[model samples]
Target: MSREEVKLPDLPVPTALDADEEAEKNLTTAPEVPVTPYTPSAVTPWSQDSGVATLTADTAPGTTVPVDDLPIAVGVPEGADPAAIDGDWKVDLAAPAASQDAGVSGMIMRVTPPADADPAAQVSIAVDTAGFADLYGTQAAARFGMVLLPNCVMDSPDSGDCAADGGTTTMSG
Candidate 1:
């Protein structure tokens, strides 16, 4: 018995890449971003001189839309490069459930905890993102999230949306 020889498929030669063009295509420089500055507004009179802060102006007529009403940001955020991401990332929000999260691109995926006994839910995200390299912040590490906001988990899941219970957040790290 004789074995038949196998022939390897012919592969095309890769063209040499121009450093300048390659750098440009890789988005070394971000596109122009618009700046929207916040303007100060006049303070409203207090209902009480001293005590709990209460607005004297009638704000009851104002309307508010439900958080659940808004659609999820399933689409990649403006200027985000989904193709740039290529790794599994895990962020421990330390909550019973993953309420909500937003990033440059992709979705938050619930992952099985390393240990079944671990009650804390785990979620997977994507790192190595682009389109936000110009943002103000120190990127000491190679991998970083362009933007991630896992909303506060409410004590009662049935109460309302996570955004509703996330009351009074004046500062964020």
Candidate 2:
């Protein structure tokens, strides 16, 4: 004997009103507060030194502080494109032999030891094309970027190639 084919029930289409129904129907009315007109004070203003003693009378007690807005550039070899960075870049602050530089755009990340770590064991973090690219994407390498060799990890999972001495780095972006 031939068996009859089973038919599935059709799902109902949502009505236009159902789709446009307002989920929140709160109708709160705030209590009205009578606002008084603001009037200027008729009394005279008090003197600055009336309550407090004058700290300086003969000379102004202030010193000018110089701020250097000059950009601090990292030492990258001349004519070397920053986009070409695609390897493990190690930065040894003591020796300076592993010190290499490259250009960047969006952001730069580095890895460093924890605060409790020994001061003498501090190592410099490095950023490569893949690291930089992963950070700001490949487009960032095209533009001019600065290097920021952080003394510690940025606290991000996908930051640089790897953590310096297996430490984590945090990412701002």
What lDDT tens digits, residue by residue, belong to model 2 across residues 100-162? 222222333332223343444322222234323333333444554545544432333234643
All candidates: TM-score: 0.19, 0.16
Each candidate's number of clashing pairs is 0, 9
- Could you tell me the lDDT of residue 52 within candidate 1? 15
Model 1 lDDT per residue over 1-173, tens place: 33567667899999996567445454466788999764323222111111111111121222211112111112122343322321222222222122222212222322222232223322222322233332323332234334433332323433334444444343572
Model 1, CA-based lDDT:
0.29
* RMSD of candidate 1 to true structure, Å: 22.2
Q: List the residue pairs that clash in candidate 2.
A: 85-129, 104-145, 153-169, 153-170, 154-169, 154-170, 155-169, 155-170, 156-169
The per-residue C-alpha lDDT of model 2 at residue 55 equals 16
Candidate 2 local lDDT, residue 119:
42
